[model samples]
Target: MKLKFTLLTLFLVLISALSFAQKSNNSQSIISGKVNISKYHSREELKNLDKGELLTLYIERIEVIVNILPNIAFATKPGVTMASLGIPETKDNKKALEENKEASDTYFDSTIEFQKSILPYSDKKDLIAAILFYESTLKALHTYEDFKKD
Candidate 1:
């Protein structure tokens, strides 16, 4: 009887595994093909994207900004010069960063209000592209700093 019970459990587990199995097709991915910076960053095509695609971009935008937070610390690091990081001591970059920060804050508050009000998903492609461009700038800055250290 114990052997029979074990066999039954094994069969049930196999059945459950099959039920949970995802499609094996690579082209049918919900988020589409290989995600990268090369993808077109235009807002005019937002409506053309699937719900999954928009959500994925939204998540990516958050991740990119979060990765950039350390750059703020980079500014305060001892012995790290602005020229080394390639962050020019200019009003323009600071102004752009401040604008992005305020936009980020507004986006956060708006997300909460949106959910509460049951609003439809707003396409954030423009904001995502802006943040991505900012992040790329940070990456270039870090790379410059690394090369300068050598």
Candidate 2:
């Protein structure tokens, strides 16, 4: 009876150990699958590009914003200069501020248009970067609008 009990206990321990090992293996596979899905391009792929080619690609996409919305470059100049000079925000600055706000709206509109035009041809990483940049620009524009209201 004593030998049978000991064998039974050993058998249970082996089964539990196998179960734990299988669980860990399953968890590791799940985590590795997630990592693979999150990364669209590996380091090796990005490294395959020739020097300046990557930069040229980014500039090419960005040029759509620059070219399509020339007003964005000049319309905000006065407000930017005033803010940089530490000039107090007063009623007199409202016109310039409003112009800046309009320019920002135009810029956001142009960015949406540019994304529609360029996204189909862009790499996954570039698309991700462009989206982040667009979000940042949108946030900045909102902030500017809030500042103008004050």
Evaluate all candidate structures by whole-model CA lDDT and list the values in order.
0.50, 0.47
Candidate 1 per-residue lDDT over residues 64-118, each given as its tens digit: 4443444444542234444456766456755665565566557656764654354
Q: TM-score of model 2 relative to the true fold?
A: 0.29
1-150: candidate 2 lDDT, tens digit per residue? 999999999999999999999655311110100000121233455457653454444444354334323433323222234444455555566465556546655765687577566656766566446534643443353345455553
Task: Give RMSD to native, each candidate.
Answer: 17.0, 20.9
**Which candidate's lDDT is highest?**
1
RMSD of 1: 17.0
- Model 2 alpha-carbon drift over 4 Å, by segment: 1-89, 129-150
Task: Quote the positional error of residue 52 for candidate 2 in Å.
Answer: 28
Best by TM-score: 2
TM-score of each: 0.29, 0.29
